[model samples]
Structure formats: C-alpha cells, structure tokens
Target chain A: MKIQLALDRLTIEQAVAVTRPVSPYIDWIEVGTSLIKEFGMDSVRALRNAYPDHVIVADMKTFDNAVYEFEMCFSAGADIATVMGAAPLVTIEACMNTAAKAGKKVMIDLLHTSEEQLEALQMYSDAIFCLHVSKDQQEMQGSTQGTEGFYVPPSLSGEGRKLAFAGGITVDMAQALTRIYPHVMIIGSAITKAKDPAAAAKTFYQLKKE
Target chain B: MKIQLALDRLTIEQAVAVTRPVSPYIDWIEVGTSLIKEFGMDSVRALRNAYPDHVIVADMKTFDNAVYEFEMCFSAGADIATVMGAAPLVTIEACMNTAAKAGKKVMIDLLHTSEEQLEALQMYSDAIFCLHVSKDQQEMQGSTQGTEGFYVPPSLSGEGRKLAFAGGITVDMAQALTRIYPHVMIIGSAITKAKDPAAAAKTFYQLKKE
Candidate 1:
C-alpha cells in the first residue's frame, strides 16, 4: 500500500513546511479539503511546485459540476482529485471523463454512500474508490478506528479495483491495514497534526514495508 | 418569497460588479460553490465587505468535517452556509449546532439525497432546507427545467419550514414557482450570466412582487 499524506487545516506555507520532511517517506500528497477551502487552487499549485515528482491529490470532495471542478483541479496540477460518490452518477461520469481526457485520476469518495449507490459505480472501473470516514466521526470515536467499520462491497473488491482508505490513520493501524492492502492508505491528522510529522510518516512508511 | 442571486464561475471582482445592481432586487447573495472553490473564503469576505447589509451565503456544500467548514464559512462573514443533506446525520447535526452557536443559518442542500434520508432531516426544521438540482443535471437538461421534477417531502414541508429552491431558475419559471412559493428562489446564470443582469433582476423582482 502506498502511503498518502493528507494536509488539512493548514496554510499553504505550513502545509509545504510539514510535507517537505515527510515527502521522502510518503508516496502521495493530498491538498486536503480544508486547505482548498482556505486557500483555493493556489494550495494545489503550491504543493505541485514544491514537490515536482510527488503525486498531488486535491480533496475537492466535489458533489456537483464535476467536469468544471475536475478540469480546474487537474489544470491546477492535481494528479488526482476526488468527487463524492454521493454525487449523481452523471457527475461521477463527468469527473471520470474529465480525468481521462486530462490523463489524470479521479478518486470517488464513498462517504455516506449506500450499498445501492455503490452498485451503480462499478462501470467506472478506471477510477479510484475511497472508503472514507468523516473527520467528525473520527473525533467522536477518538482515533481512526472508524476504518474498521468499513464495509467493502463484494462487487467492488474482487479484481482490478483501486481502493483507498482515509481518516486519522496511525502507525499501529498501518500494520493491520497492510494485510488488506488498499491501493492507498490516506493518513491525515495522525501525521499532519503530529508533533513530529516526519517521524510519524517514517513510522508509517516503515510499517507499510513490513 | 425572497430572491437569491447565486454568483458563480466569476472572479471576486466580476461577482461584485454583477451583483451590485442586482442586489437591490435580491434578498440573499450566494458566494457560489464555484466561486468558493476558485477564490476560497476570500470570496465570502469580499462579498460581505462589499455588501455589509446583504445576507451573504457561502455555498460551502460541506459533506465532511461540518464543524470546521461551517465555522470557517461563518467566521468569514457569511450569514448562511450550506451543508449537504447527503452528509451523515451526525455531520448535519454538527453543522446545525455550529450555525446555532454562530447565530447564523445553515441551508441543508438536498442534492442526490434519498427520500429515506430526507425523513431523517425533519428534526433540523430550524435549518433552511434547499431543494437543489445539481448544476450538472441542469446543464445536461439544457436549462433549469430540472426544478420542475422537484419532489418536496411532505414531512419536510409545512408551516414554519424554511425551504429554498435553486438551479437555473428563469423569469418564466418564476411565475409558475411563485404559487408553490419557496422561501428563497435562487437564480444564478439567469441573472449573473444575462447580458442585462440589472434588467433580469428587476424583472424577477417585479414578478416576485406580483
């Protein structure tokens, strides 16, 4: 599993400073929803400029006007951008098409998506499906234990599936998560909010290899 | 019924200029999701600064981390902010609480939300419930005609239930919609994209008073 570092609730400068040390340990960088809301596309451009080789994911959490959003995101240098699975299928399709045309990727966020909704998304096999826990739910539950409750739809998992898992992931959870081996393990507060983000990232990186 | 002008896909300057004349006729100014995505909270701050007395809405379309999103939006000088009804009940509840604390308002966006989900939201009666047709859906249908198929959940509508309707509202539709009389009728491109925005707003304003 590739480790993706999610930077949120931080200014562009702070995000860059935090990620500089952790960059070597993490595989992908996420310009999180908070950062995007606080700083706009400049946040994505800032990370892309700083880490030339790193894959940048703009957590747009887009629910409508997918084509416009995905177009703007990819144009702003996002290698991958996310749209909510809760969005209409046409919107998801728009994101997929926009990504494909731009040679970028779209991560479909499955936050609060029903099983029936999940069934309709199977045809978008090229896209990455994210099993996400809301940040509020994580805070309420204390840790990233919400990932344990993730139900992988049988139709979505068997073969050639690109799945990502995100919340407040920690080094301890990394060990167990490695077994299931999602395509990407998105770590946010556990690393970004850490007193020692580089060390936290290193620990998760080392655990991913184990 | 109040008229809301949705400023989208425009720079902060363009948004201000477009809304300046239309402001007299509109009750609320929505710093639309597109403007927010492109310009961040600065867009809300800009509109609020420009029109001190106007009700400025930050269309945050928050789906996760409601407290953080709503707090940021409200702090940025928005009189109202939107959270997706498609969001988990806990997240929506968090938004309601946050908005309550701020003495602001929350508009729950019912985009791609199921009837069963709508049933769960009746308790948040204090919040303004928006019956939104996605921008993508409206575009696909060639106009704002998607609002015609809107199904207002009986449980959600009645006396004292504040409901808003959005998505490409036109002058012709305004005549038809006035009978059902949603609390706020949001017009976007219909005014902002018009060659004569001032005239469009005046026309709608006249229609509303009729």
Candidate 2:
C-alpha cells in the first residue's frame, strides 16, 4: 500500500517546509481541497516545484465543471485529480476522459454517493475509487479505524482496480487496514500535525512492510 | 425578482470590466465556482472592492470543511456564499450558523440533490435555495427554458423563503419565469457570452418589470 500525505490549511511555504522532512516515507502528496481553494492552482504549482519526484494529488472535490477542473489540475502539474462520485455521471466521465487524454489519473470521492450511484460508477475500472468519510462526519461520528464497514463492490474488485481509503486515519490502524489491501491510504492530521511528522510517516510506512 | 449576473471563465480584471457595463441591470454579482477555484479568495475580494455596494455572491459550491469555507468567503467580502445542498446536514448547518453569526447569507445549490436531502434542508428558511442545472447537464440535456418541470416542495413554499433558479436562462424565458416568481434569476452565458452583454441583461431586467 502507498501512503499519501494530505496537505491542508497551510500556506505553500509551510507545506513545503513540513513535507521535506517526511518526503522519503510518503509515496504521494495530496494538495487538499481547502489548500486549493485558499491558494488556487499556485499551491499545486508550488508543491510540484518543491517535490519534483513525488506523485501529487490535487484534491479538488470537484462537483461540477469536471473537464475544466481536471484540466486545470493537470496543467498545474498534478499527476492525479479528484472528482466527487456524487457528481453527475457525465461529469465523472468527463474527468475520466480528460485524465485519459492527459495520461493522468482521477480519483472518485464517494463522500455522500448512494448505492445506486456506486453501481453506475463501476464501469470506470481505471479510476481510483476513494471510500472517503467527510471530515465533518469524522468529527461527528469518530474514527472508522480504517475498515469498520468496508465492502468492495464486485466490479471494482477486479485486478488493477485501485481503491483508496481516507478520513481520520491513524498510524495504529495501518497494519490491520493493509489486510483489506487498499492501493492508497490518505493520512492527514496524523502526520501533518504530529510533532515528529517524519517519524510518524516512517512508522506508518514501516507498518505496511510488517 | 432580482437579476444576478454570473461571471465565470474570465480573469479578475476581465470580470470587473465586463460587469461595469451591466451593473445597473444586475442586482447580484456572482463570482462563479470556476472563477473562485482559479483565482481563490482574491477573486471575491477584487469584486467586492470594485462593486462595494453590489451584492456579491461567491459560488464556493462548498461540499466539506463547511465552517472554514464559509468563513473564508465571508471574510473575503462576499455578501453571500453558496454551499452544496447534497452536503451532510451538519455541513449545511455549519454554513447556516456561520452565515448567521456574520450577518451574511448562504445559498444552497440544489444541483443533483436527492429528494430526501431537499426535504431535510427545508428547515433553513432564510437560506436561498438555488435550483441549478449544471453547464454539463445543460449541454447534455438541452435548455430547461426556465421552468419545464418546476415543483416547489410544500415546506419551501412558505412566505419569505427565497428561491433562485438558474441554467440556460434566456430573455424570452424571463417573462414566463417571472410568473413563477423566483427571488433571483442567475443568468450566465446568456449575458456573459452575448454580443452585447449589457443589452442582454437590460432585456431580462426589463421583462421582469413588464
């Protein structure tokens, strides 16, 4: 499993300084929704310049204007961009097509998507499906310990289909979650807020090996 | 009913210059979602600076981190900010409470919202409920001509509750849409992409009075 460090609520300079220490342990970097809204595509550009080798995920949480948003993210040097699964089916397809054209990737965020919506999305096998619990939901309902109600949709369970899990993940939950075999584990405050962020990320990275 | 000029896909300077001609016809100035994402809070601040007296609606289309997003919009000098109706109830409430505390307003974008979600949101009587069909949807399904299948829930039909209708609004539709009596009519490409945007806006504004 790969570890993605989510950068949010911080300025570009702070994000750059903070990530440098933990760079070796993280395989991907997520330029979170708030960070994008707060700083625009410049934030993405800054991170791309800072970490030239790491995969950057622009967490746009895009609900509409999928084609434009995905194009902007890719132009800003993001390797992958996210669109909400709750968006219109055409919107999701727009992202997929745009990503395919650019040789990039799209992650579908199933934040509030219904079962019916999930069923419709199963055909886009190449898109990464993120089983995300909202930050607000996490605050209200507490941590999910990575796999409380984990159920992979059959179509998405095929080989080469990528699955990502997010929302209040802790280092302690890393080992058990690996059993479910997620392609990416998105960790935010657990590492970003840690006093020893590099060590925290290293610990999670090491756990994946165990 | 009021006319809102939706400014999108333009630089901040271009947005300012474009609205100057139609300022009298438009009651509200919307810094659209793509504009906000492309330019960040600076877009809102620029419009606010240029049109100090005009009601500026920053269409954040906020789906999560509700409090932070609302706070950012309001602080950037937007008189009204939008949140997605499809967001969690707690997220909607956060927007409401933040708006209430700041003496500002929140518009709930009911784009692709489920009936159950709409039912739950009826309690926010003061919030402006926008019946929006996205640009992608309009392209895929054709123009709705203002009110093709308009249905107002009993709860939202109460006095003083504001409703805003958008999506492919044309000058011809204005006369018919006035009968439905939406609080605000959000017109985008119909005006922004018109040969004479000011004349187009004036035509819609004139129809409202007739």
List residue ranges in candidate 2 displaced over 4 A. A143-159, B143-149, B153-155
TM-score of 2: 0.96
Q: Which clashing pairs does model 2 show?
A: none
lDDT for A165 in candidate 2 is 86
Q: What residue pairs clash in candidate 1, if any at all? A: none
Q: Compose the digit string of candidate 1's lDDT tens values, residues B1-210.
A: 888899888899999999888889898999998888877899999999999999998999998888899989888999999999999888898899999999999999998888898999988878899988789987765545343545678988688899888877888777778877789998999898889989999999998777
TM-scores of the candidates are 0.97, 0.96
State the lDDT at A76 in candidate 1. Answer: 90
Candidate 2 CAPRI category: medium
